[model samples]
Target: MTRTPASRRDDYPVFRRLQTRWMDNDQYGHMNNAVHYALFDTAVNGWLIEEGLLAETGAEAYFLVAETGCHYHSELAFPGWVDAGLRIAHLGTTSAVYHIGLFAEGSGTAAADGRFVHVHVVRGTHRPMPIPEAARQVLARLFPAA
Candidate 1:
């Protein structure tokens, strides 16, 4: 059986709103599981970019997704809107694990919850690099409990 969705909205310090697209739903009439990853990526990267921590094409520091997974609690279809809640679960020297919850607009409960783990690497060498100080500060706000 599919896992019940878990809400971490209260746990997250910030959220990014995303509008659904007609193509997001599958023939089954609900948003496909694949789309969850897209939303996760968009929320995280969008925040990173907006905070001036990430460069789209020419940054010395880059992040590569190392792991991701999601659990859905309810059905969400196309033309709907969602708020992607984000928080830092774990921050290592070169990797950060983020917890994410997707809430339907005006819904306090989460439609899905999951994690995104990314490993920071140097652009030229592709080797693990420590998280930049700037990004860490923005990310640290999410880690206040740490």
Candidate 2:
């Protein structure tokens, strides 16, 4: 069973431009599936870290991955640059859903789309933590009221 991707360049709430490394491509001549998740993680975490929301000291204040999945729409190979888009689709008391779109540079639509859910938890205690107001502010921008 195949699912169509719902990602487009325009659907991305935030853009993170990335350069495809030569090593990203597998012998099959396309970027491996695992690489796409790496890109998605990079884009999302980079945004959070840059925004000072997910820091080493405060990382536990943020939850780790609870669920993740990606849908491939087209082949993207090495030497090609991509603009990774990020957005929040759902926000919960202790979890959040992020939608990531991978677009080939200059393309209007997405090459791949992914959804990741993370449940915030305490560092050592491993208990669910409430989503901070500061983090909510960022997520709100990506998930405005409909």
Candidate 3:
């Protein structure tokens, strides 16, 4: 199988700083693979929340994770900070793909890189729907040149 290269923090359009918790570490000492996925989820979802796109009372639709994958370039443990760099790879009428890079504090290279595709659907009906204009506006910031 071919290998994918890790992305640099500079390649991303936005970043979220997340703290590694004590429970994030595995018996092997480094963070468990599951935690990395959690970080990816936290980064993307947290950004949306911060941008005022997601709210408990006003939410109309929910973006469901349709697919995700990750590649690790280095190991990370607890008690340190991680920078989750984010960018948009694609945005369709009802779907969006986000690319993320997890960088250790003060490191230029990424410890892990990942991508996830989300499909927008009505909250109660679960039927596919077009992404809201507000969401598109915020997502466009991640692709300024597009």
Candidate 4:
């Protein structure tokens, strides 16, 4: 079954503004398909870092992307900015599923939407590990009420 894309910016609880690079566009004159995943990765990890849940290095644990998929509703190209809207769809012991909506600046509907799954792992061994309590608390803030 196909899922409908989020139709409003307010569907997400957090937003991250990203400047689109000219290089992000493909010969088709639109952002490359792969670039959507890059934006999703940047939005989620950047938020984690901002919340003190992740570090560039020397952290006890960190998250690694396990799965990701995107659905496009409209086109996005360079020479513009993207507002990535983020929320936690599922938060488990060792992983979380992040839902993201990519909206063209000032647009209420998402140009694209996707899910990114991150699994917490030990820094050195990379073994699966429970998400840190501190991180969980912070992530919980992104959970929208059902």
lDDT score, candidate 2: 0.84
lDDT of each: 0.86, 0.84, 0.89, 0.91
Worst 10 residues of 2 by lDDT: 54-63
Candidate with the greatest lDDT versus the true structure: 4
Residue 45 of model 4, lDDT score: 85
- Over 39-117, each residue of candidate 3 has an lDDT whose tens digit, in order, gives 9999999998888766475478888898999999999999899999999899999989999999999999999999988
lDDT comparison, 1 vs 4, better candidate: 4
- Scored against the true structure, residue 91 in model 1 reaches a CA lDDT of 90
lDDT (Cα, 0-100) at 110 in candidate 4 = 96
Residue pairs with backbone overlap in model 3: none
Q: After superposition, how far is residue 76 of candidate 1 from its true place, in Å?
A: 1.0
Query: What value does the lDDT take at residue 108 in candidate 2?
Result: 87
For model 4, how does the per-residue alpha-carbon lDDT over 67-122 read when each residue is reduced to its tens digit? 99998899999999999999999999999999999999999999999899999998
Q: Is candidate 2 or candidate 4 better by lDDT?
A: 4
In order of appearance, the predictions have TM-scores of: 0.90, 0.91, 0.93, 0.93
- Give candidates' CA RMSD values in order: 2.0, 1.8, 1.6, 1.5
- Where does model 2 exceed 4 Å of error? 58-60, 144-146
Q: Distance from true position, residue 86, model 3, in Å?
A: 0.6
Q: Considering TM-score, where higher is better, how would the candidates rank from best to worst?
A: 4, 3, 2, 1
Give the per-residue lDDT digits (tens) of candidate 1, residues 40-127: 9999999888887666698787899989999888877788899999898999889999988899988888889989998999888879
